[model samples]
Target chain A: DARVTQTPRHKVTEMGQEVTMRCQPILGHNTVFWYRQTMMQGLELLAYFRNRAPLDDSGMPKDRFSAEMPDATLATLKIQPSEPRDSAVYFCASGLTADGKGAADTQYFGPGTRLTVL
Target chain B: DQQVKQNSPSLSVQEGRISILNCDYTNSMFDYFLWYKKYPAEGPTFLISISSIKDKNEDGRFTVFLNKSAKHLSLHIVPSQPGDSAVYFCASGYKAAGNKLTFGGGTRVLVKP
Candidate 1:
C-alpha cells in the first residue's frame, strides 16, 4: 500500500521561531498539495506543485510562509517567524496527473503534522 | 465566504440504520463533488463522489446523490457501524480550474450499537 509520508508528526515551537514540515509523496505521484486545518478555518489550501513546479501559492502568506518541492520525492512547507495563528495541522496530499486537466485529480493525503506555536 | 456548507455539526445513528449527511454549495460553477471521511489524528480518506452530469452514484454500502439545480449533495451510509463513526467533509471543484477542492465544515457522525 502506497501512502504519503510526513515527518515530525507533531511539533511545538515558540512564536517567532522557524518551523519546517516535510512530506514525501507517493513514488509515482506527480502533484503535491499543502493544506492547513484549524478549528476556525476548517481546511485551506496553502499551495501546490505539479511536476516539482509550483502551480499556485496564492493562499499562502507571502511574508511568513513558503512551500517548495525541491525534488520529486521531497516537498516542504516552511514558516519563518511563525505566529500563534499559524498553529494548525498541515497536510500534504499527492495525486497522479498526466495531463493538466482537473478531471484526473484524485488526491491521497498524508497523516498530517500537528503544529503548536506558543 | 463559505462556498460549501454542512449545516449540521454532528449526527447520530443507530447500528444497522441509515446515516444521511447533507451538503449545500453556493457556487454554481462547481462541477465535481466529493465526500471524505476523517478519523481523529488521521487524514481524510476519500469516500464517494458525484459529477454534475449524474444524479446518483453508488458503491457497495455507500451512495452519493447530487442535485445540480438545488446545488445540493448528500452521502448515505446504510447499516452504519461503529467503524463508520468519523467526520465527513464535503468538497467541490470547478471543472476549468486546477481542481483545488473547496471543502465545507465537516459533520461528525456517531454510530451507536
Candidate 2:
C-alpha cells in the first residue's frame, strides 16, 4: 500500500514567481526522479537522485531550475522566476534502488503537481 | 531528437476488442522498455516492462513485445474494457546510462463500451 506522495497538487502563479514542489518517496526506496510533462515534450526527466545523491540533471535548465533531495524522504524541485513555458505537470517517482540490484524494477509515481504559470 | 516515439495521437476501439499500441525507439542502447498508463489529473502508472534480452513479457491481459533489430516495441491489451481507456506512454532507458527514461508523447486510447 505504500506510494509516493506529493504536495501542492495544484499551483497557480504569475510569471516570474517562484514555485517549489515537494515529494515524499515511498519508504525504503533508494532512487528518486523528477519529471516534467507537457503536451509538446511529453515527459522529460528533470533530475534524479540515487541514495540521496544527484546522479544526472542534464535535462534541466541551468539558469533558473534546481532540484535537491535534502534527506531520504524528501525531494524538491524549484523554479525561480518561472515563465509561462514552465507550466506543466511535475511528477515524482521512486524506485527501490538505482540499479536493478535492490530495486523493485519499476518506478512508482505520485499524483503529480500541476503548475500553471500565467 | 525524440528517442522514443508513439506516432498515434489517439485511438478508439470497441470494448471486448484488442488494443494494440505501438512504439519505436531511436536509441540502440536502450536496454529497458516500459509502458505506462495515465488518466487525467493523475500520474502515469507503470503497466508493464520488458528487457532487451527478451522479446515478450506478459502480465494478465497486458503484454509487451520488443524487437531489438527494428528498435520497436508494442503493448497489446486483449478483451479491452472500458476501464482501459487512458493515455498510454512508451518509455525506454539504458541501464548503463543512469536509467533515466525517455518518454514518448503518449497515445490516448478510448475504449467505448
Candidate 3:
C-alpha cells in the first residue's frame, strides 16, 4: 500500500511570499514528476526527475520556480515571490522505469497540495 | 499549443449505461496514451493505457481504443456506476520524450444513480 505523499495539503500565502511544497515518492520508485493544475490550463507538467537527477524543467518558470530531489525519497518544489497566477493544485507522481520501460507506462499520484496566493 | 485535448468538458450518464470519453493528440510522434481519473480534491490516478502498436486494451470494465491514423483515442466504461463519476484526463507521450506526460483538459463525468 505504498503511495506518493505530499505535505501541506493546503497552503494559503500572500502574494510575493515564498512557498515550498514537498513530496515523498513511493519507495523504490525511480522517477518523479511535478505538475500544476489550474482551471484555465488544466494540468501542465512543470518538471521531472529520474534517478535523482533532473531530466527536464523547461515547463517551469525559471525566475520564480525551482524543483529538486535532495535524495531518492524526498523531492521539493519551491516558488519564490509567489503570485496569484501561481496559485494552483500541485501534484507529485512517481513511477518505475528501470528496465528500458516507456516513461509514460504508469504513474501513481499523491494527494495534491492546494496552493492559494492571495 | 496543446498537444493533447479532451474536447468535452463534462458528460452525464445513467447508471448501468456506458460512458465514453474521447481524447485527441496532435503529436504524431506520441506512441503511448493513458487515461486517468481524478476525484475532487484528489490527485489523478492511472486507469488505463494503450500503446500505439496496439489498437485496444481492456481491463475489467475499462477499455481504451486507439486510432493512430486519426490521432485519437477513447475510454469506454461499461455498466457505469456512481463511483465512476470523476474527472477523466487523457495523456500522451513518446518513449523518446522521457517520462514527461502531456495531459489534456479533463472531461468530468457524472453518473446518475
Candidate 4:
C-alpha cells in the first residue's frame, strides 16, 4: 500500500532553536501539502506544492516558517527561532496534481511529526 | 472566520446503532465536501466525500449526504463498532481552486459495546 511517510515522529526543542520536519509522499503523487493541528486552531494549512513548485504559503507565518519540496518525493517544513507557540502536530499530505477528477480526488496523509517547542 | 462548522464537540453511540455527524458551511464557493477520521498520534485520513451535484454517496457502512441549498452535509455510520471511535473532521473545498481543504473543528465519537 502506498502511504505518505514523515520522519521524526516526535521532537522536543528549546525556544529559539531551529526545527525541520521531513516528509516522503506516496509514489506517483505530484501535489504535497503541509498542515498544522492544535487544540485551539484545529487544522490549518501552512503551505503546499504542485509538481515540486510552491503553490501557496499564505497561511504560514512568513517570518518563522518555510516549506519546500526538494523533489517529487521529499518535502520539508522548517521553522527558525521556533517559539513555544509553534508547538503542534505537523502533517504532510499527497494528492494527484490533476483536477479532472473533480471533488472525488482526495489526499493521503502521513503519520505526522509531533513537535514541542519549549 | 471559520467557513466550515461542526457544532457538536463529541457524540456517543452504542454498538449496532447509527451515528450521525453533521457539518455546515457558510461559503457557497465550496462545491465539494469531505470527511476525515483521525486517531491519536496520527494524521487525519480521508473517510468519504460528496460533491454539490450529488445528494448522497455511500461506501459500506459509511454514507455521506449533502444538501447544497442548506449548505449542510452529514455522515452516517450504521452499526457503529468499537473500532469506529475516533475524531471526525469535515472539510470543504472550491472545485475551481486546487484541492486546498478548509477543515472544521472535529467531533470526537465514542462507541460503546
Error of 4 at B81 (Å): 0.6
lDDT of 1 by residue, A1-96 (tens): 999999889999999999999999999888899999999788898997888889889889999999999899999999998999999999999987
DockQ of 1: 0.61
Candidate number with greatest DockQ: 3
TM-score of chain B, candidate 2?
0.98
Q: State the lDDT at A50 in candidate 2.
A: 85
**If you score just chain A, what TM-score does every candidate get?**
0.95, 0.94, 0.96, 0.94
- Taken over the whole model, the C-alpha lDDT of each candidate is 0.91, 0.92, 0.94, 0.91
**DockQ (Cα-based) for each candidate:** 0.61, 0.54, 0.72, 0.58
Clashing pairs in 1: none
Worst 10 residues of 3 chain B by lDDT: B92-101
The C-alpha stretches of model 3 lying farther than 4 A from their native spots are A100-102
Model 1 lDDT, residue A83, Cα? 100
Instruction: Give the count of colliding residue pairs in each prediction.
Output: 0, 0, 0, 0
After aligning candidate 3 to the native by TM-score, how far in Å is the CA of B31 from where it should be? 0.9
Instruction: Indicate the residue-level lDDT of A13 in model 4.
Output: 99
lDDT tens digits by residue: candidate 3, B18-58: 99999999999999899999999999999999989999999
**CAPRI band for model 4:** medium
Clashing pairs in 2: none
- Order of all candidates by lDDT, from best down to worst? 3, 2, 4, 1
lDDT of 4 by residue, A12-64 (tens): 99999999999999999878899999998899999978788888899999999
Worst 10 residues of 4 chain B by lDDT: B92-101
Per-residue lDDT tens digits of candidate 2, residues A1-118?
Answer: 9999999999999999999999999999888999999988889999988888898899999899999999999999999989999999999999865554433257899999999999
Candidate 2 ranges beyond 4 A from true positions: A98-104
